[model samples]
Target chain A: MKKLVIRSLIIVAIALTAAFLTNLLRPEPLAWIAGAPYNIFSDCPETAQHALPLKIGNVERERDFFVDARKAAQFEAGRIPGAFSLPYDSLFPADAAKVDEIREAAGGWRIVVYGDMPGAKLLADDLFSQKAGNVYYLEGGLDAWLAAGYEVEK
Target chain B: MTPKKEKLKTILAAVGVPLRVYIGAVFIAASLFKIYEPYQFALSVATYQMAPLPLINIFALALPWVELVCGVLLIAGFWTRANALLISAMMLMFICVLSVALARGLQMSCGCFASQDAADEIGVHTLLRDFAWLAVSLYVLLFDDGRFGADGLLEKWRKSHA
Candidate 1:
């Protein structure tokens, strides 16, 4: 029994070590780890950007670095003027090429995102950690921008 | 030891993999639900009011990651013993939290299934469910039931190679 206990402890220690090393090697294991709690707390409607109202003029004085997190169909219908469209799920850190593309477009500028509200914030956090410049979320999403009478492209 | 005792141990070892898989899948679904809605999970943690704001936020954010990583490991049988132990520890934590809520008569959700349509409310059912899950986890911790796992296959391969 003592031997069995020791062996089990050793195996557990090795496994934890491997997990630590794996996370260390990967740039964004946080994406995988941080997802659980979010799914539990939100109702579907609350997650939508347009569902919640936003703070006014949250994107003033920002450069042309807005990324629309909504789907293509949503983006084509309407979006903040001069904002680039990069749907949320597409921004995984493993996709280095896409990250580079986003980095190049938003060069030396504040990158603001808004989907339906703060739904974009989690995506922005992941992108910012990957070195996207100065990421922000329009306090209220596209609806807020339109509500504030800001310029929007159809 | 008696023959029956030996036989039972063998049976437990044989059935370990399926049991582990069931537990792992549960954690995976639970964790994924929370991950898909992090802010909501954060709010749930805040509602508990046991920990301070900053601590609660960080815990709310990271706990799901632990569950996911460990759950995946458990499923893949990559690190069965470690993941089993980690899950057991997590179950104990949950039991503590659920017990407190029960004692206080706090009507809050257990936050176990983040994507559920129900509000964060707990009662006798939640407590019983958590205890049951905890029992299952404890059983896994005590037994290697690694039957269909990669860990079992690897061990077999190693013996053959040796």
Candidate 2:
């Protein structure tokens, strides 16, 4: 039993070594201890970085347009009222033409993109990179919207 | 040797090697993506809504490497019992997580393979698949005597040298 324990420890040591080595070679090395106070700014675009709270509230109604960065099915099920569907593709990186199409339709207003997960941030980042300066992603996606007592529009 | 023990050894020889290799190969394959994309894996783990935020990164950083080493050892047939035991424990953990997530109606990806964005969504099928793998690991732990693959070769060498 002692031998087994020793062998297991050896295996663990080897595994940790490999993980550390590979991580060192990565372009964006992960912080071993996460939840850093500034982690929100790490992947966010330069514009999003200055947004302070990062999460847009109250949908902005007629003044701002909402973009659903999730699938068409999810968008159709329920969404912020009068939101446009961009349906971010999970299988592929953000599509340039699809994002352009959404941008064109939004007419230079404040565009708030959202998804069930980080897809919204991904789309918002892409849009902001393409010079859509007014783009922002909803915090925590649709769930956050509902959590804050906001109504969904079927 | 007793007849029953002989039977067990034969069972190990016939089934254990192939099972170990297959499971080991799979684990190695699964770990490769997670190892390369730790940040994405961390996001996937977060979506499960189970692990505390502070520790999700730890699992993201370490679990893939553990899987890789165990897989390689299992395939080599070195420390066959230990490797099988570890695999069984991981499988049990996965089973419990999947069950709890399903019971609470969590809609998320399994993150079993590929990036979180490209992973198979969690569901009953994934649960059954994990259960199947767990059974294989249990079978190996119960039957393997380390008298095959690298372990057997090392033993034969030790006897001849002695």
Candidate 3:
């Protein structure tokens, strides 16, 4: 029993060492272990302030360009009127051309991205990181938008 | 032994070997994705909203390595029972998390494999699949006689030395 336990420990140690070595040798190690400091949602009040509720009155008053960051199918099913479809997953660093297209369309207009809350936030953050100016996200997403009786275009 | 009993044993042992291999292979395959994309896995874990913020990274970093080691050990037939128990525990933990997520109505990805997206919603199907794997792990824990592995050979060598 003791021998078995000892051998198990050794195997576990070896496996972990291999994983550690793999990470160490990688060009871009996993972000968490690489000790990269990330700004949590709470730390960025200025960014959070950019997130707007789906109140129809507020939305109607603003001249912001809304970007639907949901999946293609979801965007097609229904979205805010005049909102352009840009799936969040496709917004990779390699997709600079697509980002440029959105930026061009916005053309100094405030970009309001919305989908699912988490996904919208992520897309907004990605856009901010890429220096997309005046980007905001819709809090609580399309569900909230619908709940607030805002008209959606099919 | 009676012929009927002997036949039953033969059938069980045959089933056990393949099941062991299947479990080990699944673990290895699952671990590989997590190992390669620890950051994504961490994000996935965070989506569950069960673990605290600080511990999510720790779980993400260590879990794939544990899975890999146990998987290899199970395949090698070395410390088969212990490895099976470990696998079973992991399955149980997964089952609990999935169950809680379902009950809480948190629409998130299972995060089992590489790609996690809005479409990868958690449901009863994920729970059922993990439960099936859990049953297999428990079978290995109870019935693995160390046959068809290095453990059998080691035992043989020990007896000869004695």
Q: Which number leads on DockQ?
A: 2
lDDT of 2 by residue, B32-89 (tens): 8899888888877766668877888888898899899999999999888788888888
True contacts kept of each: 0.08, 0.39, 0.20
The sequence of per-residue lDDT tens digits that candidate 2 reaches over residues A33-124 is 77652221122234344221245443455555677888888888999988888876656655677667766766644567888656777777
Greater DockQ among 2 and 3 belongs to 2
Where model 1 places Cα greater than 4 Å from the true spot, the runs are A1-154, B1-6, B108-118
In model 2, the runs with Cα more than 4 Å from the true position are A37-154, B109-115
By lDDT, the best candidate is 2
The clash tally of candidate 2 reads 0
Local lDDT at A30 for model 2: 93
Candidates sorted on lDDT, descending: 2, 3, 1
Q: Residue-wise lDDT of candidate 1 within B1-162, one digit each (tens)?
A: 999997897788657767777888888888775666655666666555565544655565566767777778778876577678778888888888877767876543321223233334567787788777777767776776454577778889999999
Cα-based lDDT for every prediction: 0.63, 0.74, 0.72
Tens-place lDDT per residue, model 1, A1-154, is 5644565465545644654555456554433233332333332112332222224543443443677888889999988777777777743542567667877876544566678534576666666667665566667677777777777888
Better of 1 and 3 by DockQ: 3
Superior candidate under TM-score, 1 versus 2: 2
